[model samples]
Target chain A: MSKHSIIISNISKSYGNIKAVDDISLNVKKGELFGLIGSDGAGKTTLLRILTTLLLSDSGNAQIENFDVKNNYKNIRQIVGYMPGRFSLYEDLSVEENLNFFASIFNTTVAQNYDLIKDVYSYIEPFKKRRAGQLSGGMKQKLALSCALIHKPKVLFLDEPTTGVDAVSRKEFWGMLKNLQKKDITIMVSTPYMDEAGLCDRISLMQNGKFMETDTPENIINKFQKQIYSIKSKNKQKLIKDLRKYKQTYSANIFGQAIHYIDKRNNIKIDELKNHLKSENHIDIEIKAVKPNIEDCFIELMKKEQSAVTNQLKN
Target chain B: MIPIIFIMPVVQLVILVYAANLEMKEINIIVINNDYGSLSRQLTDKFSSSPFFNVSFGNSHKEANSLMKKDKADIIMTIPHNFEKKLIKEKSADIQLLFNAVNGTKAAVAAGYCKNIIFNFNKDIIVNSPKLILEPINYKRINIINQFWYNPQLDYKIYMSTGILVILITIVSLFLSSMNLVREKEIGTIEQINVTPIKKFHFIAGKLIPFLIIALFELAFGLIIAKLLFNLPMSGSLLLLFVVAAIYLIAMLGLGLFISTVTETQQQAMFIAFFFYLVFIMMSGIFTPAESMPEWAQKINYINPVAWFMRVIRMILLKGSGFAQIKNEIFILTGYSITVLSLAVWRYRKTG
Candidate 1:
C-alpha cells in the first residue's frame, strides 16, 4: 500500500468559461485529516468530486489509493466513501433503512461494522424508525456520517457537512472525525468556514480555484508577515474610514465589533496610530497588535492574489 | 408510490371500461311514405317505436336521399306509391332502404337494426294473413345467417379491460422505473451510488427488478379484478400471457431507462415518456381496428411494441390464439426489448 492515500496533479475543471477548479494539485497522506478550506465556489467541492472519481478533471491525473481516477475508478470506488454537500440519502426510507441500504450496496451489513459507526449511530439509533427526511439538521449529519462510515472504507470524503449545522453539532461532528482518524482512514473534508480549518491536521486555503497557501494551521498563521491590530472605537464605522486614510494602513476590515487592519510600516508605534485616530474626533480608541488567525491570513492572501492578477494585466 | 400502484389500476379500469363503447344506437331514419294507406302508417309507427331507430316523415323521396347524403339521416325508407295495391294484387311490394355508408361501422350497425325491424314487420303480415303463406312471395328468398364468434355478445367492456390492463402495466413500469432513476439524480443520490464499486449492470438490475415485480403484480391483480367484474374470458394459456407480458415489460422498462439516461430531472423524463406513450396508445389499435388504419400507420405498427402487445393480448384473451398463432408478435417484442435495453445500457455513463 502506498503511504499517500490521495494524489492529484495539475487538475483543471471548467464550467463553461468559468474555471471552477483551475490548475490545482495536492495530496493526502494515509491516516491524515486534510482540509480544503475555502468559501463557496472556491472549487472545494469540484476537487473533492474529482478525487472521489465522481467527476473527470479537465486536465492532469488524480489517484486514490494508487488507483488511477480515470481507469481504476471501479477500484477507487470500492475503498472510498463520500458524503456529498447535500442531504442525499433516501428521504422516504427510515434512518436504519438508509444505513442498511448503503451498507448492503457495499455488500456488508450494519451489524458487521457496528463498532465503526457506533459513535455517530448512538445519536440516531433512537430515531431508527423515523424517516430520514424528518430528522433535524444535526441528526441528519450524524446519519450521513454513519452511512458513509458503515462500509469501513479506506478513505472518507465529506463536503461541507457542517455548513447548516448548529455550533454545538459542528463542534461535536469535528470531535467524531478526530476519533475516526485513529483507525487510519485518510479523511479529506472541505468547508467554507475558516474556524473549522484549525481542526484539521493540515489545510490548504483556497481562493478562486487556486490554493493560496497550504500548511499546518499554526504554521500558516505564523507565516502572516503583516502585523494585524485589533482596533476598537466608540464608533467602528467612522473608525474604519478614518483608519483607511492613514498612509501606513495596508488594509482595514471589520471583524465582529472591532476592526482588524494591517500596517504597511512595521516599525510604526502604537501611540502614532492612536493619535491619528484621535485626531479624527475618535475618543477612547484602543489599539493592540494581536496574533493573526486563518481568516486574517485568508483576507491578506486574497489581497495579494488580486494585486498579482492586476500586475499581470498591467504587463 | 405504493398507494398509486394500488389505486391506479382500479381507477383506470373503471374509466376505460365505461368510456370505450363503440356500439352505435338511435340511428335516425327518414320515411318517405308515398302511399297514404293504413298499412304504410302501421309500418311507420313500428319503425318509430323501436329503440334503435328514430323515425321522421320526409316530404319527398329526393329530400330523404339528400338527408342521408348530408349525414342528418342514417337511413332512408322510401315506400313506393300503390304499395298496398301491389302487395294485395301482385303478392309483392318494393320498399327501398338506403344507408349512408361513409362511417362504415356505424352504417353496418344501422343497416342491421333496419333489417330486424323489417323482418318483424314481415312476421306480423304473415301471422295476420294466413293466405299470404301459401304464395311465399311477400318476402325476398335471400336467406342470411349471422354467427358471431369469440365475443359473441360483442361486449366492449371485455375487450377494453384486457387492452387497458396492458396499457396500465406498460405505463406503471415505464414511469416508475424512469422516475425512480431521475429522482435519484435530482436528489443527488445517484452521485453517491455511482461512486460505489457496484457494476453498471448490477445498478441497472437493481433499478429494474423492483419496478418489474410491482408492475407484474399489478397486472395479475388487475387481470383478476377484470375477470371477476366483466367475466373477461381467458381463452389461451395464462402462462403464455404472462410470459409475453414479462417480455413486453422489459421493452417498456428499457424505454424508461433510456429516457432516464437522457433526462436529468423527473419532470423531463415524465414529459418525454408521455410523448412516446401518447404515440404508442393512439396507434396501438385499442380504440380502432388496425386494418381500418392507413397503410403508413399499419407500417408504423411494426415498430410499436404496445401495438404488438395489444394485438397479442386480444388474440390470447378473446380469440384463444396459441403460441404458434402469436409467434410473430412475441418475436417482434423480443426484438424491441433487445434494442431498447441495449441502448439504455450504452447511454448510461459511469462518469460525467
Candidate 2:
C-alpha cells in the first residue's frame, strides 16, 4: 500500500461559469483523521466527491492507495467507503436490510465485517427492524455510518456527517469516529461546524474552492500574529459600533456576549483603551486579553485574504 | 404496487372487454314492397323479426332512397313490380339492394345478414310450391356451406380480452421498471449506488429482474382471470406463452430503462412512456385491423414491441399457434431487446 492514504494534486472542477473546486492540492497520510472545514458552498463536498471516485476532476491527478481515480476507478471504488451529504440509504428497507444489502453489493457478508462496524452499529441495533425512513435523524446517521463501514474499506469519506444533527449526537458521532480511528482507518470528513475542526488530527480551512490554511488546530491558532482583546459594556450593540470607530482598531466583530477586537499595533495600552471607552460614555465596561480560537483565526485569515484581493484589484 | 401487479389488470380487462366489441347490431332497413304480395310481405317479416336489423316500410323506392340518404336507413331493399309473377314464370326474381357504406366493416356484416335472410326466403318458396317441387330439375339452387373455425361463435370477449391482457402486462412492466429506477435518482440514493463497486450492467439487471418476475407472475394471474371469467381459449402451450412473454418483457423493460437513463425525474419518464404507449397501442392492431391502417402505420408497427406482443398473444390464444409459427416475431423482439438494452446500459453513467 502507498504511504499516503490519498494524494490529490492540482485538481479543478467547474460548472458552467462557476468554479466549484479550483486548483486544490492536498495529501492525507495513512490512518490520519483529516477534516475539510468550510462554510456552505465552499466546495468541500465537491472535493470529497471527487476523492471518493463518484466524480472526476476536470484537471487534476487524484489517487487512492496509489490507484488512479480516472483509469482505475473500479479499483479505487473497491477500497473506499463514502457517506454522502444526504441520508441516502434505502428508506423502504429496514435498517438491518439496508446494511445487509450494501454488504452484499461488495461481495461480502455482514458477519465478516461484524467487528468493523460493531461500535457504530451498536447504537442503532435496538431499532434494526425499523424502516430507515422512519428513523430519527441521529439514528439514520448512525445507520448510514454502519453501512459505509461494513465493507471494511481503507478510506472513509464523510461529507458533512454531523450537519443537521443535534449537539449531543454530534459529540457521540465524533466519539464513534475516534473509536474507528483506533482501528487505523484513514478518515476524511467535511463539515461547516467550526468547533468540530478540533476533533480532526488536521484540518484545512477552505473558502471559495481554495484552501486558506491547512494545519493542526493548535498550529493554526498560534500562527495568528495579532493579539486579540475581548471588550464588553452594558450596551453591547453600541460598544461594537464605538470600538469600530477607534483609530487603532483594525478588526472588531461580536463574538458571543463580548466584542473581540484586534489593534493595528501588537500591543494595547489598557489605560488608553479605558479612557477611550469612558469618553464614549460606555459604562460597566470590562476588557481583557484572551487567546484566539478557531473562529477568530478563521476571521483573521479571511480578512488578510480579502485585503490581498482588494490590493490586486486596485493595482 | 400490489394493486398494480394483481388487481389493475383484471379490472381493466373486465371493464374494457365490454367497450371493445366490434360486432354491429340494430341496423335500420327501409323496404319498398311494390309487389304487395304475400312473398314480399314474408321477406319483410324476416328483416323485422331478425335481431340484427330494424325494418321500416316506404310506399315507393323514392321514399326509401331518400330515407337512406337522410341517414335514417342503413340499407334499402326494393322489390320490383310483378316480382312474384316473374319468379313463378321464369323461376328467377329481380331485386335491388343498396347499402350505406360509411363504416365499411359494419356495412359488410349487414350485407351478410341480409343475404342469409334472402337465401332462406328463396328456399322456402321453392319448398312450398307444388309445381316446383314436382319438377325439381326446373330450378337449380346453389347452397353455401360456411364454417367458422377456432371461434365458432365469434365471441368478441375472447379476442379482446387476450389483446388487452398483453397490453396491460406490457404497460405495467415498462412503467414500474422505469419509475423504480428514476425514483432512486430523485431521492438521491443513486449516488450511493454509484460510489459502490457494482457493475453498470449488474445495476441495470438488478432493476429489471424484480419487475420482470412481477410482470410474468401478473401475466399468469391475468390469464387465469381471463379463463375463469370469459372462458378464453388456451389451445397453445402455457410454457410457450410464458416464453414469449419473457422475451417481450426484456424488450419492454429495456425500453423503459433506456427512458429512465435519458430522463432526470419520474415525471419525465412517465410522460415519455405515455407517448410510446399511445403510439404502440394505437398501431398494434388492438382495436382495429392492422391491415386496414395506412401503409406507413403498418411499417411503424414493425418496431413497436406492443404490436409484436399483441399479435403473438392473439395468435397463441385464439389460433393456438406454436412457437415455430411465431419465430419471426420472437427474432425481432430479441433484436430489439439487444439494441435497446445495450443502449440503456451504455448511456447510464456511473460517474458524473
TM, every model: 0.90, 0.88
State the lDDT of candidate 1 residue by residue for B220-279, as single tens digits.
Answer: 989988988899999999899989999999999999999999999989999999998989
lDDT of 1 at B195: 78
Per-candidate RMSD, Å: 3.6, 4.0
List clashing residue pairs in candidate 2. none
Quote the chain B TM-score of every prediction: 0.83, 0.86
* Candidate of highest DockQ: 2
The sequence of per-residue lDDT tens digits that candidate 1 reaches over residues A220-246 is: 999988888999999998999988988
lDDT (C-alpha) at residue B229 in model 2: 93
DockQ for candidate 1:
0.67
Please, what are the lDDT tens digits per residue for candidate 2 over residues A1-315? 668989999999998888999999999999999999988999999998898888889998898899989999999888889999999999999999999999999999999999999998999999999999999999999999998998999999999999999999999999999989889899999999889999999999999899999999999999988888999999999999998999989999999999999988876798899899999999998999999988898888888889999999999
Per-candidate fnat, comma-separated:
0.78, 0.89
User: Cα lDDT of model 2 overall?
Assistant: 0.90
Residue runs of model 2 more than 4 Å from their true location after superposition: A232-249, A269-286, B26-45, B54-142
